[model samples]
Target: MTDTATTSSSGRRILFRVGWIVLLLLSALFAVNHIAGIWFIAASTDEQQLFEAFGVVNLLAIVLLVIPYRRREWWAWLTVWLTILPIALVVVFVPDAIGITYVVTAGVMSLGQLATLPSFRPTRTAN
Candidate 1:
């Protein structure tokens, strides 16, 4: 590749990496919020358990993003999407039940994930 092309490609790679890192940070923050809600707030057992499950899913996303997703593994990306898409659908279908905050947050995270798609594109290999 020419110098300019190489430079642009490098810049894009860095930008995408930053995007995914932002996702990881977001997941961590949500995980903490969910787990803390279970302990610090007074909720019924069902609610507390539901929040705990949310926390666990967030933690799992963090791990997946940090490891295989960073490596641009297709399966890892798909797995993360599998987890996110369902929740996004729920937020879309039942906005009132989930609340506006989550609706907004889900939109932001989905946009962020979309922005980072180039990072997960399959690389070409020369024979």
Candidate 2:
């Protein structure tokens, strides 16, 4: 590759790493939010079942974040989208302070994935 192409490729790799970092941060934030939400809900309702359900969902979301971290592939994007879409929908329909927080944070997470999509292009190997 020419110098320009090499530079571009390096730049893309850097961007991809940054995107993954952002996604990781978002995952952490979501986990914290869900944990707190579960705690508050459990306290208010005395509902262990609800707590367990939300806890399981939160754990699953955090686990799924690892997929994109380990493999920058299209499916990773889909996974992240699947994780965020329900939160986004709740934000849209609920119209509460917490919902607004979800929308803003999830929106940033979505944008991070969008920015990273170009970097996920399959690298061409030499024949």
Number of the top-ranking candidate, with TM-score as the measure: 1
lDDT by residue for model 1 over 15-123, one digit each (tens)?
Answer: 6777686778878888998899898863799879877887898899999988988887878877877556545665655669566666666677777677677767855
Question: What TM-score does prediction 1 earn?
Answer: 0.82
Q: Which one is best on lDDT?
A: 1
Task: Write candidate 2's Cα lDDT for 22-115 as tens digits.
Answer: 8777777666655776656556554545445545655666676676445766776777787667667767666999779878877887887776
TM-scores for all candidates?
0.82, 0.76
Which residue window of length 10 is worst by lDDT in model 2? 46-55
lDDT of 2: 0.70
Reference-based lDDT, each prediction: 0.76, 0.70
Off by over 4 Å in 1: 86-98, 123-127
